[model samples]
Target: MAHWFHRNPLKATAPVSFNYYGVAGSPAANKICNDLRTTRARLLDMFTDITCTPEVMKNATDAYFSLLQSFIVSPDGSTQDNKMRFIQNFKWTDTLQGNAPRHVAQQDMVFELVSMAFNVALWYTKFASRLAGKENITEPEAKDVHRSLKVAAGIFMNLKEMHIPRLITPAEKGRDLEPRVMDTYIIQCQAEAQEVTIARAIELKHKATLIAALAYETANFYQKADHTLNTLEPECSSKWRKYLQLKQHFYMAYAYCYHGQTLLAGDKCGEAIRSLQEAEKCYARAESLCKEYRQTKGPGSTAKPSEQLFFIKLGGLIKNTLEKCQRENGFIYFHKVPAEPPTLELKASYGLAEPVPFELPSLSEQCTPEVYATFDLTRGAKNDKAKPKEEEVKPVKEPDLKPQKDTGCSIS
Candidate 1:
């Protein structure tokens, strides 16, 4: 009986014919027939292993078939009415006749079939949403859905890739090719699966770094923009400090990119690209840095990004500053006066006994022996004539020079 049922159940059943005015060999017929056949086969296989009473098996089979047929006819690809009809008519649990193994298998098969059908219905809803021009989903929602799908796909793909020794696994040893069918099923599941978190993590890490770098670069660029707008020296250190702050932030941004790139290289190509791209943005900020420095100093005082050496070295800073000044003001030239040493001049007082005649050197005559002799001879002659004559000295013999005594006291 089991052999007969397995071989030709349809032939054993009573046949009924109904005439319908429909195209027998049209594209629509082919499409519909294929869908119907596939759906029927899936449901039949799901129930085939059940060890149930004949009536229970018949009712369950008829219920599944009717539901599939209704789905085919429904414009939306799913109908609540069809689901309700299946639920009302199909008593799947009753079909298993106290056979634990068969009951569990049958239940699992039914659950799988129902889930597949539900997925189809959901897909139709998504299609409807897209058709209505309402596909502008939020980022969070999209990310959530994408993440879910990726995870599902990754798991299924992993399962499909699993290899087993044929002798060790029961399914592998079976000649019925159930293992091969299971592998195919896993592959199909993988095809519709979502991406994995590890992959996403790698991708997002790089993206985040890129965004941060972009922000830092943008802020740095804007901070320096004021340099071009102002002409005078910055009154306070605020602008300079701001410029330095920008540079510091930009450095940090680059650091983030570098770190992110390292992390991404492991398994995150997407993230690595993002981080590197951000680093590029930081490099572009050089222009803005120059502009800001020039604004505070002068148009010619613009500093290069690579000119950090000047800030660190004393002489370099002075030289660069001078060079910048010269460039802005054209050639720099100055006439400096030589400093003189201190000296003293001599002058005679008018209270002197002899009128001292100032002797000055003759400008035309050169100092020689004849000039010195003439001046000395004239001076000596004058001194000799003016010599005072000493008269005969009258010598008076002083008798006695008496000592005078004090009036108050007698001479003691």
Candidate 2:
């Protein structure tokens, strides 16, 4: 199962000191700053250790975001001005922005919100991958994998729709928070979550037609995700796009193979034969792409997708089903094989994955009104202490996001 999913390394970040600028130092304010530093460090450290459970992550994230809310959004929904935003500097490196530790920094708290949320989303993906890679996954573990992916998708979508718009400086192209990368994360998480559902359905002895439809829709999700990165440089995006491409073709093969079985049950031997033929071709193409993916130079940990049981099962199913269809057609019906393959089932009526809704926790108790009132409101003065110079970010070559509509599946 380790080979079932491809994962990029987590984005690196610089530590924050939370030094207050032009403010009278008080216990509450100092406590708040110390809490911010402690909670943020805890949250960031979780990424380095994937074995941390979701409950631990939630508590750490909640503690950090609760304190962070005072800097950006208040408990009562009041918008803070530039004076509050420019008080602290936050820096983070992009995931696909090369091997060096080059980072982009901003004197804006909203930027901090976006970068931290992005990391949290990535942690969910890593958590899901860790769960999925176990030698034997139980029913509860499978459900955990499914839920983690949906939560990850939700966080990415939340960053895109809510926080990204509020950033004082827009995210540059190819950065993790950019719209294209955001869409890629959202789509990929949902698609992988659906993979769990497809596995469950197969185990439950669901109809071949249902499994085929689900597989086809899952393939569409991966294709859409891959297309979002099309405008980026090949060096930055090629490996990831190849991963998506291979998964797309692999699920398509799954669709056609199960579809052939459906057709066989309905006594459409000719159509079944043609469908199985298409399945074989798609599986072969996926196999080639898997090899290319391994050789491609890029970021992220390489996965041997071709060696996974899920992949191996499809090839065996395609071979056995195709043979059965051919043997039955020759001895029983002798129906004419059509020139074109049958159209794949476009949509699955049920079990499609949807992102869960997410919102930051409320302002922490340490950020009281007295502490909020003590901060200086003027932006004319800058922090005299030296800080990391902001890196020059390249303009994005990405298009506007065009997210696919979900089937309104219940994530509960």
Candidate 3:
């Protein structure tokens, strides 16, 4: 499963000393700054170990952000005037655009919030990948894999919708915080989550028609995710795009191969043969992409997807089923094959994945009024003067694929 998802490394950041000197403030602010520095360091370190429990990461995240809230806004909902007073420079590297560090010096803490959240989302994806890489995942591990992806998707959406808009400075083009990058992350997480559902359905021996529909929908997700990156530099995105393209083609083959099985069950031998032929074509395209994926330079672990058991199984299944369909058609009904492949089922009534709803935790108890009052709120930061208006990030719109007839058993 590590090989299944293309993950960029977690965004890197320079250490924040959080030193406040010569400024008039309560002594608690100093303790708060120290807490901020230590807690953030712990959270960043946790990401280095994919095996770190989510509970630990969540605790560290809460500890840091609780203290951080005082810097952004007060409990009264008024934007803090001293937001830009924190002299510590927060530097973060863009996950996709390039490796160079981008720094925000006393501009706004919202930038820090957005950058950290992005890294946290990346951690969730890496955690999911670690769970999936297990040689023999138990049922619980499978569900964890699915749940982790949904959480990651939710985090990405949360940042896009809530935090990025609050930044005093807009994210630069090709940066990780850019809307296009966020959209790609959201869609890819969702598609990968649904992949788990498809695998579960197959293990449960659900109906071929149902599985085909789910696979078809999953392929569309991968295609959509890839399309979001189409305008980016080829060298920067080609490797990641190749993964998406391969998954798209591979799932299309999965859909057609399973649809062929369903058609055979219905005694429609000619349509079955056509469906299998389509499956063969898609599988061939995916195979080529697999080769290309291997050769392409990229960040993250190199995966030989073609060598995976899942890939091997699908190739075998398509070959076997196509032969069976052709053999039965010749020996028995001798039905004429359709010139075009039959329409695949588009609406799956069962086993589609959705992102888990997510919201940032409320400001921590450490952000008391006494602490909030320590920072001067009289003068606006220089950066806040005549800020340029930026385009609002549009919410991601998803089509409502209403469930059709239940062609197979449903998962409760």
Candidate 4:
């Protein structure tokens, strides 16, 4: 049994006591905050279970469903502009300490673990669903995953709504608090949500048009969620630093892989190869970060073996697929190793243990530009005026106007 399991076994199923991080005025705020607290606490309990039986897993899914419900937005939602008001507060403290570190609490770490597990569960559900007629997964396993997805979609939709900070800005905030913190949470949630979406895509790979649609959605979501985790680095502790490093780079790499897949689907071989190469590079860094975390933190606290394996296989698949892309392209390019890996930003800035070079090119480079500049006559004239003049400017000529004689018929 894992050491974590011994902490409290029966409490795993007990209801969590909901406490406020700040004052929530409305019924909607109270319900959402209370529910979020309960959900996080419940997840923390299940994460410690060494024997995560099917029954336990089912319970976890149930709890997730309840929590997930709180985040969902209805077109005629009762909680409009009310639930997020408290969370949008600048002085909102989630812990007892006035200036507590973001990742200090057990629940903070466990919430992230829950997110990872939830995504893995989504994959398993879709995976088992695809092979439903086949012999791999039992009927019960398929049912469990299906249920998990129904709940997970709630979380994914919530993340989607909050993809931009403006989306989460509760109309009741009265005054704008520091939105940076909440934005980080939105980013992390969006990334995990996209990963779950990708897993569904992977399971449906046999359908070409469907695969293309999924590929586009996956690539776009991942592209958006990428690099947003960088905000969590300075404000977090070592544990969060490690988790962020592993997740951020891994998803960035995963996003690139999906993009490569998208390109390959479109028969853009050379572009696909370039994207896959970028994926290869980011995955390598993710691998290194994961290793470093294990070495320093011990293998005690992390997602279960099944969850971890999905990403491991994903990394390997990226490698093999990348090689395949290169071979089929009829060209191979070797990347030159930098003399010393570029200094990790977390090391210098936050003093996080990670030295892995995770900073890389963004994948949003693939998106169609919505706004662009096109210079024409006015812009050219402006540019001409902006040039440094060695001599005085000449006076402009005014248009000539001739006076005309008026008809005298209307003398009155």
TM per model? 0.18, 0.91, 0.88, 0.38
Look at candidate 4 and tell me the lDDT of residue 140.
53
- 1-412 per-residue lDDT for model 1 (tens digits): 0000000010000111111113213344334335435545443434323233223433444444443433222323443222111211111111101122111111122232332332222222222112111133344433433333333333223323331221122322211113332232232222222111211332344353343333334333333433422332243233333344445444433434443444343543344344444444544464355456545531111223333321123123223433433343343322121132111111212111111121111211222223222222122222234543432222211122122221111111
Model 2 is weakest, by summed lDDT over 10 consecutive residues, at 401-410
Clashing residue pairs found in predicted model 4: none
Which one wins by TM-score: 1 or 4?
A: 4
Give per-residue CA lDDT, model 2, range 1-412, as digits (tens): 7657788767666667676644635667667877888999888777666468989999999999998877775534566463466677777777785555357888888888888888888888878877777756778888989999999999999999988998878888887778999999899999999999998888887999899999999999999999999998798899999999999999999899999999999999999999999999999999999999999988877887787766888899899999999999999979999899999846799999999888898778877777876666553224555654643433222222222222112122
lDDT of 1 at 101: 12
Prediction RMSDs, each to the true structure = 59.8, 6.6, 8.4, 28.1
Candidate 2's displacement at residue 60, Å, is: 0.2
Candidate 4 regions off by >4 Å?
1-183, 206-238, 265-267, 295-301, 304-307, 331-412
Task: Write the candidate numbers in order of decreasing lDDT.
Answer: 2, 3, 4, 1
Model 2: CA > 4 A from native: 21-24, 80-82, 377-412
lDDT of 4 by residue, 162-199 (tens): 42233333322211112332333333333333443444
**Best model per lDDT:** 2
Clashes by residue pair, model 3: none
Off by over 4 Å in 1: 1-234, 298-304, 308-412
**Considering every candidate listed, which one attains the maximal TM-score?**
2
lDDT of 2: 0.82
